[model samples]
Target: MGLAVGAGAAGLAIGGGAGIAGGVALGRARERRTADAVASGDGIHQPGITTPVQDHLHFAAFDMMARTTRDDVASLLQDWTYAANRMMQGLEVSATGAVGGSPEAPPDDTGEALGLPASNLTITFGFGPSLFDERFGLAAQRPAGLERLPAFLGDDLDPERSDGDLCIQACADDPQVAVHAIRNLSRIAFGRARIRWSQLGFGRTSKTTSDQATPRNLFGFKDGTANILADDAAALDENVWVSASEGPAWLAGGSYLVARRIAMLIETWDRVRLSEQDRIVGRDKARGAPLSGGDEFTAPDFAATDGSGTPRIDARSHVRLAHPDQNGGIRILRRGYNFVDGNTDLGRLNAGLFFLSFQRSPDRYITVQRALATDAMAEYIRHVGSGLWAVPPAPAAGQSIGAGLLGA
Candidate 1:
């Protein structure tokens, strides 16, 4: 009788575990379907997702607030341009020029020379529930919602995987303003549902010499040759492009994946010439594309040789390693912005990239980046920004706004 009881207990335990696993599998399937529906324009709404109302707020607020409106979107696009531009002036002044791991470590000056600090500094902020649901379009479906999927838990909410409804970002000469802008936005959304938020920056010690900073790795050659290029065009239409045609009608104008990262290491990169730099990076120093290339997506022949008889696709090149073996299998959609700080280490420097990319699966995007991290560029760029989120499906109408799906 005792033996029988033990067998029954084991069966119950196994059944319980299986039940949880089933729930997870179901949730993922639901999430995938929601993305597909929205992409396909199907109009079937998920239970707890948010809507594009927030995106409207972002558009309108910036349209009204900025000094220029003729090209508000254009200006926003411009904000993403250069590394040490006026947009980051505020951050450069207020930033302590400290690395992520050490509070006392000073910013590396060589890093500054290579234009690294011009883009590494960043302060991120997100809206709260109040602003997200009511002020934004995620309001309950009872009277105005479109009805979408339920909110995600840990698995779905992985920062790298999700996107946000609205994003308000700006950089001045000081980091304080960046912090202020983010915090202020959060306040505006506080009374309702809260959005996820965090700040990410850079790290590291100095190699002290330009040779150490040379665009090469310990392997001694230029690197980062085949990185995929990204602008709003690629991100909005090509990559984050989901087909939710089967989703609820209200979710018609939704988008996904607002990824961000803080990549560092500049001093060593400055030692190379502009032309050499272009080859190492696999993009024009100013235009950011292939050296033997056409547009951002145009493929460069790795096997091509340069005038120096060197492999056009340097083995250590960022592009070569990312798309190695002449195989085009790896591709990550990048939507990154640049930042800089000259004030962090008592006005010295700390810089790198504000890495951001989006994809249907974190594994897909992360796998490509992992290759870069281990490639020749690893010594230069270290990942400091990390988070995952479940961009809620567009909101539904006349149900509970962004409730079940968002929190479920």
Candidate 2:
């Protein structure tokens, strides 16, 4: 599909006799509604939140520049809303696109994805707790559930990559599509925001839909075996999406996202025996069956014993502690991806899972993470970065993203 006409053009077309001010307002409203509809899944494009987990991810976090005003931030969001709508539909950022603009000035779009398919690209935006501080006059509107997460045991978080004022999660079947989205968005925010840290990931480790096969992590185990499926509306309402009555009207349909950069001790883990690995994970590496002897989807028999009368699933095994049964039946939607950045200074692979989960509240993650503090697998992984973001709901046909919170 072609890129939507610019608001200025739309205004000029209809403003011939009506005057610029009124026509501009009417044109913007019309263009916004069109953009919102396209993003809301009226066609092939899907909004990021509901979009199926793709093969690649370009996750970025940014801090607002010191001189950017609240109004500037709002304008940026509006621009992003329009640009994202076009990109998701496989079009350029603007009508002039990457190469059609004036020769003297830089192009509006970077053009890396010029001939690529939409590739099921989705761009999701989020707000961090710091954004609601005194800087933007948004403190009063901050959701009670959007608090900063407390440091967890065994967390080796890097200050530079931990938190940010804003976040954008771009996912696509093709890596270039995902990268292009972030690249153009960053360019758009030139004077307003600077990327704090970013991570590129591949090999999704979770299944958001039943049609997809369960994927594996670097540890060679089927991950997210008991994940919350997108088809389960009730489960999502109960665990993933935040409701209006929950508090903070602006965040009624929003969700909280927690991201962790976990670096695996691959060399150490690789040398472990197969049986030992199964015991540590509480599941067979190949079959992904519970150690108690059932299929991948079979309910784990945490109480079962072995031939020697020992607990089949170790008391401190990764699964036992992370299981919902042990954590008040709390479940978060996992959409993690495997990452291999490069080799560490010591010649070890600097690679692991980029853990991403969405839940109704931060407490959901906090509770489960704390329970995993004593997990046997903790020794094989170290958390080097973390972030918490409040992901607002998709825009309606006439609304901009976070319109309720920003009051734009």
Candidate 3:
């Protein structure tokens, strides 16, 4: 479970202390000038989820066209795998790229990322429940834990943005690099599949590596303070990754991904009192310390109470319900992002967290989400769009993505 060593534009060494700031600045400069850099063969096709999370994200879900056959879908995944392998190394989708193609034909690559580095670009693919339907003849191959997620209490889901037959998550340190990955993949799909909905996210809402500083959500509170880190190999294997004995063989090394688009009621939250805000989240806004705690990582003293005899961490507080203690020790790897898509019809800022989590089974999320159904924070946030996807493991050399599931 040691970290894999790789050589590519994304493989810049991140130093610590004062060097951290310098390292980031230098990394950005290198990214800008790495367009022509040749990538080493190592770590080119590693699974993105296991790799450190990137700074920006472009996540999209697509549905297959009605006339598209199962074989067509399989071929699309194979083509996507080939293209993704090159893109991750700062190369074009094909040998004859954007400007090298014939004048009468469209270029193989979309030129948006022409001069950009890989920027740690990682494109992960997943299959939705709908993909295993009758159209694909894949129902019997579906994993036992890959069923559709149940509706929660406060959900106000938008149908168009909810479910999909397939999903692709492209993340990178550079925003344009992430966008370009998705754009070309969608282009490659062409008539076989079309985008159902997509989300663009800037600053990360959670940190996956120990070296990274905790990022803040749109709610202005530090998010994922107790999140599972990539270095926690034991926890990752037990909670995040699906084992061969856990379910269907096709999904042995896979994981379930749950995405919830939680929209914050910004105007209303802005007007709320600071103390009330702290009470709602059960943590100090400035320090991220628990109400009955010592520091940011201090375990909450849920049993401690004030002289008034009330629980220090309120029963309905978010931290209390979402805590692993309350959810049978279940934890999911959160890799969320903060998003703002202009103003709403009422002219208020439309902003919130694009909450994403990966787990061995969807039940981990379902259990915790049901617990938070009555959380005080639910009053300030609305669950708008949602999706559950079964993410397959990374492909080996000479294999296509999801080769096991598609029998490729």
Candidate 4:
């Protein structure tokens, strides 16, 4: 079968140009570790909250030639690595603090890597079983197949199956320098080996989810009523980390998952009156707090009856339904970004969100979003972008990833 690409928006998956680009960019996996505790119900769940650094650029490439030799791949990659490292060094000067104070915040080396970070550019790559097949006699097929290799490309894949594969990632504090570096790298490496598909990502902000009480989306209600939590390492490992049983013993070090893109219609959405917008999203427009009551981060009481004895948090209220119980059950881990393009409407805004989330499966997170898409907010938003691909896991210790996969 031919290769397929996809991207995620909130939760839904769209198709076309955005799909192909998102496919190459969105499928990469990495977590921003946090250093503080988040306020949730009774106590708090703080698995060291860290945001996925935005300034870092991410690039994922697939090998088109399923029949190339491993030695050739290694030779080509060696040259690519030298080039990328030098490029990242230069990009760092423009990044937050790399040169001076970041336009945003400079890179914080203190805590773990993903802990609320943003670099000028972050680049990563993944190799399928086909890349390994040329030398090890194995073909990686499904999303799970990447987990068994040893020395996982590290952040996303398992450690047992990462051997004999090409997985490379690099990050810096600059954007313009990063783009030029990658363009140069591609020109040199693209034809050296068989490239299947490739993608690049640029992040403009570090905050993916809004804090409680923060202004919600166009719908007016405090958004993110349903977000997942990560309280400890074990949970993070189980719920967030990829496994190694999917691929060959030598290929167990990787991970894979699909990503999709979505576009929101702010202009059309703005046409509605304030009250209508609030009713649809179920949150206050200015504060993004729960309607009829509750503080930022506080759960809404769904069972409490309204003036006529009807449920205060209506059965259909986005927040109420997302949190059926006072304990808040409708939570999903959200990690999205914002994107803005030039205006085509003469003198108006033309921008939207690049919604992204990581979950065990699409069924849990996406199922809920499907319902919202058909709700009152449907007319104000459209699925204009999409892409899909299995994100290969991070690289392990003592190994310089990308060396083997790129036929370096």
Candidate 5:
């Protein structure tokens, strides 16, 4: 019953009494527009990777059942791909959506998102390191860099929320749309796979297009002020999508995704003095400019000095340490979100950033995170849960996702 006609790139919709089953193609075309459409003529890359971050996210990880066979995984992907493609276009999981299904049977699509526009929904799939073992006979096809992420400083990762055999990231302007996506997908995988962990997030903390303003994190600083824009194809090639030469041919044009659930000690940070806060983030409190005296977009002057000859930008400051200039020009495309899962039992707010980034290789993320081992802001955040997945190229029409690896 969700809006059968998704408003396209223009971002408009006609809801209520329009009939949910017809005019589905008009919804698909308007909802997707060309910006995030399949990039290669063969549709070699997935949509959500660079499709301009949406306002809400419902990310879930899954593991295949113990007795599930290779065919099970293949069939799951085929069904999931078809459903995902349809849902992204503002259609239901199937033609017999919600109210259309037989009265005796459960609705094919959840009714929660009924009457909602597509809201620019996008579903991206990924394969985790654990899925590369003999279970599926995929060890030989595994990319060389695919492995569990090594430990880092200030980590208190929770096993209950850490790794999974697979992951799906659903993003949309409407919270209901995003959640609806994961719900239906999970329903479809019921017999073969179950959820390992999931996170619901809001208030996107980054942007993929220059037109969108940089968003703030729970810490109240502008995050990703210099994030790579979607128009910068050169930057994406250099830092994001995997290339043919990288081998494991199935992943070319695809990217590696890293998700870190960072728990912020927001109360503690709120108590810190403004000056100290600025130093920790290394940016002006109001404008997000570097301490070295420049606007938000100006290149930070790491070596500039104050009146007393002290370095204007602290070497341990987050801005200084995470800058591409200091890290061999390495950058990851961030599509993070802010999350507050209500309050903890202690009467403190349990909130933080759900950081999501895409890079050409896993090593790229490891290198950057390693460089942040001594970050000044480390005092205010804890890396509580983490995961890394190798995303495969978008499949051609009628083909299931990851057909390259499964030979489906």
Candidate 6:
């Protein structure tokens, strides 16, 4: 994202691209990182996780409408599943589609995405902590570590924008397609669910395959230099997917999602000295290689030193503190984005990193974040909004999205 792993999560592709999954409960994990696969996941886990990071993101959180029944919730999910599948296949949301609908009424498909290919679209659904309450009768099914994200240092979270009963992460190469997916899904929700707070992001800061090069955040530094790949089956199993031994059966093959809206102090950063900036980040801004030396992929040598006997890396540097070596070997998969919501009244750009990470558990993130409390870059950024969602495994063949947790 905009800042660094301090507001970020980690999952570096160990052997090139998305690592291969080993003892996965989800069906056969893809063996190789293809250039592209519109429907990439193997039907066991959702598509967005290991799928190649898309160019745009339309992430939304929803709260079920008041006075709705369990059946209402189930119906909404079924409707969402069917429609999401259709859109991913590059078809209309319904048979009638936008232009073919009745002239006397609104159209089934919004028509905005008509004629556009799938654009490798993926729609991932998740259940927020609030949904574990009695409204849907799903308390016992809540995974053990599923709860509101703990307060972290430098958090400026907005109450109205943080948590929700449900969340949907729609990613695609086309912004229109991504937006259309959320818009149509919201329409399908109708009176059953309404948007809480949503974020629109573009310029992906991570990649999952060898074909895609490392992308950069607004901070002018490359990210995803070592992120999980689309074909790394092993890494997916160990670092991303939740294991059966760690779960309440319903969430076994799924992973937890952490979202943070970080605001970058653009003006302040633009004024910092280049050398000081490199020291704060602990990497060569030009190559993303550690100040400790080596190429971008060279593991950082935290103990390297310079002339005059000064430490090459600052103790509080972002890379030094956030590295897995320093975090009890905990790593999270990051697929974050650099975001800019125009400018503020003071004529400064309201921009930052929209941090997104998928981990085996929420604690994985909490652990890494906790280690970054003293991050030097924390002075240049502030976490504005946050959330945690339990992403259930992909439904069985021919089943709707949440058939497991909802027990439908």
Q: Which ten residues in a row have the lowest lDDT in candidate 1?
A: 52-61
Tens digits of per-residue lDDT for model 5, 148-220: 9999989999988988999999999899999999998898787899999999999999999888998899888
Candidate 4 has an lDDT of: 0.37
Q: State the displacement of the C-alpha of residue 293, model 3, in Å, after optimal TM-score superposition.
A: 2.2
Clashing pairs in 2: none
lDDT of 2 by residue, 1-408 (tens): 111211211211111111101000112122332343431122211144434678999999999999788887786777677777667667787777788877777777888988787777767788999999998899998888787789989999998988899999888888998999999888878788989999999999998778889999999999989998866879988998888898687777778899999999999999999999999999999989999887999999999997899999999999999999999999999989999999999999999999999899999999999999999999899999999999876555445567778766
Model 6, span 1-408: residue lDDT tens = 100000011222212222111110111221211111122234566767777788999999999999998887776776776677666667676666797756887777788987777776777888999888888788888887989999998898999889998999988878998999999999878878999999999999988787888898888888878787756778878899888899898888889999999999999999999999999988899998989899888988887889877889899999888888998888788989888999989999999999999999898999999999999999999999999999887665445667776654
What range of 10 consecutive residues in model 6 has the weakest lDDT sum? 1-10
Candidate order by lDDT, decreasing, is: 5, 2, 6, 3, 4, 1
Model 2 Cα displacement at 336 (Å)?
0.5
Compute each candidate's TM-score over C-alphas: 0.43, 0.90, 0.90, 0.55, 0.91, 0.89
| Per-residue lDDT over 164-277 for candidate 3, one digit per residue giving the tens place of the 0 to 100 score | 999998888889988998999898888789999999988898877888888888778999999898778799888998898988876776789999999999999999999899
Model 5 scores a TM of 0.91
lDDT of 3: 0.78
How many clashes in each candidate?
A: 108, 0, 0, 89, 2, 17
Error of 4 at 81 (Å): 5.8
Note each model's CA RMSD in angstroms: 21.4, 6.7, 7.1, 14.0, 6.2, 8.3
Among all candidates shown, the one with the greatest TM-score: 5
**Once model 6 is optimally superposed onto the true structure by TM-score, how far is the C-alpha of residue 288 displaced, in angstroms?**
1.3
Query: Which ten contiguous residues of candidate 2 have the minimum total lDDT?
Result: 15-24
Against the true structure, candidate 4 reaches a TM-score of: 0.55
The TM-score-based order of candidates, best leading, equals: 5, 2, 3, 6, 4, 1
| Local distance difference test values of all predictions, in order | 0.32, 0.78, 0.78, 0.37, 0.81, 0.78
Q: In model 2, where do residues sit more than 4 Å from their true spots?
A: 1-36, 39-46
